[model samples]
Target: MSKKPAGETLYVILGLLFIAVIGLRTISTPELWTHLAQGQHNAPISFLASDSAVNTTWLYDKLAYLMWSIGKAPLLILLNIVGLVGAFVLLLRVSEKWGGALSQGFALLIAGHLMFQMIDVGPEVCMMLFIALFLYLLTTQKSPAVLFGALIPLQILWTNLHGSFLFGPILAGLVAAQAAQQAKPSGGRKKNQTNLSGTLGLLAIALLVATLINPSFIKLHGQVIAGIQSPAPVYHSSLFIEYFQIPALKPLILFTMILGAGGLITLKKRLPLTLTAIAVFGAFLVWTSPYHAMLFAILSLPFIVLSLTAISEYIHSSLEQMLGGKAKLVPGIMGGVLVLLFIASIIPAATGCAY
Candidate 1:
């Protein structure tokens, strides 16, 4: 492991309490309370299949119950904060792996908007840590066996932990596809891509199998699909306003688009096909299901961070050239602009996710 930089640590500590900043603007509803109450003496799997009146899977219900057993109900909230903070910490680490300092803008954006929300004690925050870790591995881990092995436990655990476990294999397939494309031979391209393609294929299939190990087995897939396809009222009237329908050109979404454009224009290095494909898919998910914008954003964060960092460097270099090599001024100017953007991003965050 490498030493973590001080700048990146801002979110790690503050993020633990980020959700608390908004005070009473919480997403916790009646259902979460019921689930935790039942989980006190019931098995975790019992809660998975028996939606009963809750009509929702309880991901961390048992955790909450066990915490309460030890006189630690408050500890449940702390874990949520820990996972949220860890997600950013892992993200910063991954972005730094690609190239140090590329994560600055994205990290700041997260701290400004994502950190302070009412996402209290849900499995989704825990889910973020896993997704972030997977992405971190995606960026730095090259060994096929290692990735495959890692996903087996992760998918199994995720499937039981949350309904969004499918994201694990889906992301894995996209990355593997990217790897295969990159590994293509100079000649007879199709033939050369086989080694990685085969490995990735096995990994994907294995991950799918891993999902089956969950309590719901194959039925879990159908349940998740049905949940997605069903026209739920949660999209519009849920307690969590973030789940509400997104307007055309919402401020955050619009800013994300502009940031992406600037990144493409300024990025000095070539964009990987894998990242390009993931970004497209991420955009589609966020557009279609605004409920999971936070999840999609976190998953695609590495690519976003990389792009922004490239833009920053490009501007600095351009300014240096324009100023006849007085590069020192460039840092001060960009740094000030970064501070301004950070301040500007908080404006919408105060209102929380505009569901």
Candidate 2:
């Protein structure tokens, strides 16, 4: 096999460096203290606090405490950075089949900027990492046994780590529907495709069951329901900010949306139904609260990049014809501009400006 392109490797390294710079910011979320305190207790549920009926993020708390005890806030910051970077890597892999590294890198930078705004030295970091990993496994795994087998344990762990674990079953169900839809067009392997879809559906159910393996058992889901109906008072402050606070970075968000739409309209082929479903789900979350903009951004990054890649290809083709041999310089200049934009995006956070 021929060696991979040097520019791809450079793009990856540069992307990672940008991520590190963004992740290096000060830990500002006050919830980190509450989580650290909870981790010191043996009981999974917080008996004294009225904020939560069940400790949905007990495992994350425990892990956070461990990291804090070792190196204090610095260690926790490192963990947050790791989660952010790991999520980006998985996003890179997921989008690789649809686009080139340059496009993937650019898309992820947009998503990461949005996602990292909400992340701190708390369970949110773990939630982001788990979400990315879960999406990767669901979309790529071919074998039903392997897919379900992996997701069940992951769900169990995620349920203990964060309340957003409900997304696991939701995603499974969506992917299962997509699989079933694909089966209709598959001629000879229709039966196999149907089986895969059926397995995914079952996996969705299994994930729901696995969620009960936590400390609160069935009561945990009740808490989820209650929280949905009326969010806990602890979230009131965040809820207010997320719902009403106009983000200064809204321009970037709008830019990504325009780019994604432009790409979708210009696409040469139909976008996959699974991606559409996921993106819709993500949009719904953001609609519920701006705090979830990251969720929408990250979940839709692959789709966005797919569009960007198509647009880039179209542009590159035009340039190739116009400039011929001199067209090679364009990618380098684009790469430099990408780096500059990444730096500019983080300037607000770096200088203590609020979102």
Candidate 3:
């Protein structure tokens, strides 16, 4: 493998630092105590006279408990840092693959800011890591051994880790559909496309099956679905602002609208269908509860980068046509605006005002 350029390495390190600057902090979530308490039961499934309390996050709780045993809350905080940083790194690497440095950096910073509040000792943090890993596998890995070996096991662990294990099969299915939609039977490429589509389809099915490996088996699905569909009373209370409905003109919502516009403007070039699907799914999550804003943030991140790239290229080309020599100035100004936006979004957290 060829060595990465020194500049690229420095860029990556800076990106990691940006994520950590926003992500690193002391754990303050009350849910951590509940998770640790439940973890002490030593059972993934519990039978009760009234209802079976299927522990969807049994593995996470167990691991959290193990960390707590070793070094108490400090170790759990370390695990949270490692998991969140790892997830952001995977996302940044994937974003770099498909977009310019400016777009990817902006996307990562926005995502980190949105996810910052979620940085705590909980299953949701673990879910963030798994989501990034699954996205990495879907986008970058094509080898059968790696895809199946990694994805199937990932689903199993994810099922036992969090209720969002359903995302594995959902994302895989979308990828398979995207492949099938793009495939055309013609020459040597036809066989390759067919195999790729078929492999991804099988992978989706395998991932779905893997979710049943948890102690609750098929019943786990019902439990998780019900949990998601059930509205928590906290959503309606005033204790947290995350559950509040986002204003239409909020900066993040406007950014999302811009991404949608970018996708529409670049329709001829064709954005990935899977991205559009995931973005829509993310919006649905936010609609259900603003507490899931991080879901929208991370899920829409790759698509946001791609949309920004397409929009940037279109603007550059259009500007070059109108003002051949001065086109670069416009994009440079836009880049500066993005940096300002990032700084503004993170200022509250960075200065400890958010805490």
Instruction: Compare the candidates by lDDT and give the number of the best one.
Output: 2
TM-score of each: 0.77, 0.85, 0.86
| Candidate 3: residue 249 Cα off by (Å) | 9.5
Error of 3 at 212 (Å): 1.4
The lDDT for every candidate, in the order shown, is 0.62, 0.76, 0.74
Q: Name model 2 segments beyond 4 Å from true.
A: 1-3, 42-52, 184-186, 231-247, 317-332, 343-355
Single out the weakest 10-residue window by summed lDDT for candidate 3.
231-240
Q: Summarize candidate 1's per-residue lDDT along 213-278 as a digit string, tens digits.
A: 855567778878887787345243556556654444346655665666777787767677666666
Ranking by lDDT: 2, 3, 1
Candidate 2, residues 193-223, lDDT tens digits: the string is 7988898899999998899898879887887
Clashes of each: 1, 0, 0
Candidate 1 Cα outliers beyond 4 Å, as residue runs: 1-28, 41-59, 97-99, 110-118, 187-194, 231-249, 336-355
Tens digits of lDDT, candidate 3, 1-355: 4665554454445556666666656766567777887788764344654655677788888888888999987777777778877887787666665576677766776676666544555777777788889888898888989999888877888999998899999889888888887877677776777789899999999999888898879988998888877845523334556665433324665567567577568745666878778887887776556677667777888777787778778878888999998997875676667666656655766687756
Which candidate, 2 or 3, has the higher TM-score?
Answer: 3
lDDT, residue 27, candidate 1 = 35
